[model samples]
Target: MFKWEQLHQYGILIIVLEENNEAKWIIALGDDFYYDQNTMEPPVGDILLYEAALEDNEVIPLQYQKE
Candidate 1:
């Protein structure tokens, strides 16, 4: 779970990525921030896809991979 600081005043986040040999979960995060943009004009509320994982599952932190 994640939210933009500007769009979401709470600035709260909880991210846990995971993979399963038996049955894996494909977590993804989509954004239109366009890294090419200058730091002064960083994008906000661009992530369009936020999927959840199984409860208590082993996980990976696809920090940059999903973002």
Candidate 2:
């Protein structure tokens, strides 16, 4: 599971790389609702990549959606 609280505590930025090579920012927050985060809006897909902000952090694959 992608834990926003855990990510936030480490000051990480979730970067989503699209097929076109563009990167989108993922905002993690404690709220259940997607609208609660000011930086990121709801994504329109089920699969994405989640990573930590550190240079040595590994990227984790995630399937997420707004409930």
Candidate 3:
């Protein structure tokens, strides 16, 4: 939850890191469909850490797709 950059052609990229300062994840939006493929599976405590973009103060709106 620090750096924020705006892409010219694509969209925005939000970087989220793990507490151990090792594992990392990127939240990207625009021109892409984000969904939790394991929605029917068990919780691994890694929901937002997956594909779906995590919202912030800069997040505008999210178009939810019917699964």
Candidate 4:
């Protein structure tokens, strides 16, 4: 139930609430940006899901997660 605009900043952060009611946050950088944790970069128009949570006022990354 999230919108693209909601994740258009601060790179990309995905929040997933599990059945246990726990939230996880996944942090991702853009293809143009460099990341040691990621081997490959996500292409444009790609939506990457992550196990992460968002702060009250945080910007989501527009980049996708590698593989």
Candidate 5:
């Protein structure tokens, strides 16, 4: 599963790629910023959700919506 988080209003972005079986993560920030699993260093809030999702085996959205 992959998720996108726009951390800044000025176009800063974070993209997370997940592979359940292999425990992989790739974080991308902005157009030229990319990090592999080893260098993936998400923010505090992001890490929280990431860890939760890993433990729960679910895809957790970055934010809640009214629906």
Candidate 6:
């Protein structure tokens, strides 16, 4: 079972690396900002793939894996 959650306000890219007992979820946050008076530029962060863990069929926070 997988529960979807809103991670980013703009957009996101998801990719399932593996599907088994130990699965890997890769996510990439989009670099787009909404036009508003308070908001000027996009989010300050590198556009890269991040790994997310699963616990009891629930997705946890994003974790950066070095490999």
Query: What lDDT tens digits, residue by residue, belong to model 4 across residues 1-67?
Result: 4444333344253334333344444345434554455645434543444555454635454545445
In candidate 4, what residue range of length 10 has the lowest lDDT sum?
A: 11-20
What residue runs in model 3 are displaced by over 4 Å at the alpha carbon?
1-11, 33-67
Residue 38 accuracy (lDDT) in model 1: 50
| lDDT on C-alpha atoms for all candidate structures | 0.35, 0.39, 0.38, 0.44, 0.38, 0.43
lDDT of 4 at 32: 50
Better of 1 and 6 by TM-score: 6
State the TM-score for model 4. 0.22
Residue 4 accuracy (lDDT) in model 4: 42
Candidate 3 lDDT: 0.38
Residue-wise C-alpha lDDT for candidate 3, range 1-67, written one tens digit per residue: 5333321222334444443344344444444434467686432322222422355434334434446
lDDT, model 2: 0.39
Give per-residue CA lDDT, model 6, range 2-61, as digits (tens).
Answer: 334423223334544444534455555445422345775434433444455544444334
Question: Candidate 4: what lDDT?
Answer: 0.44
TM for candidate 5 is 0.20
Error of 6 at 18 (Å): 1.2
TM-score of 1: 0.23
Error of 2 at 31 (Å): 22
Clashing pairs in 6: none
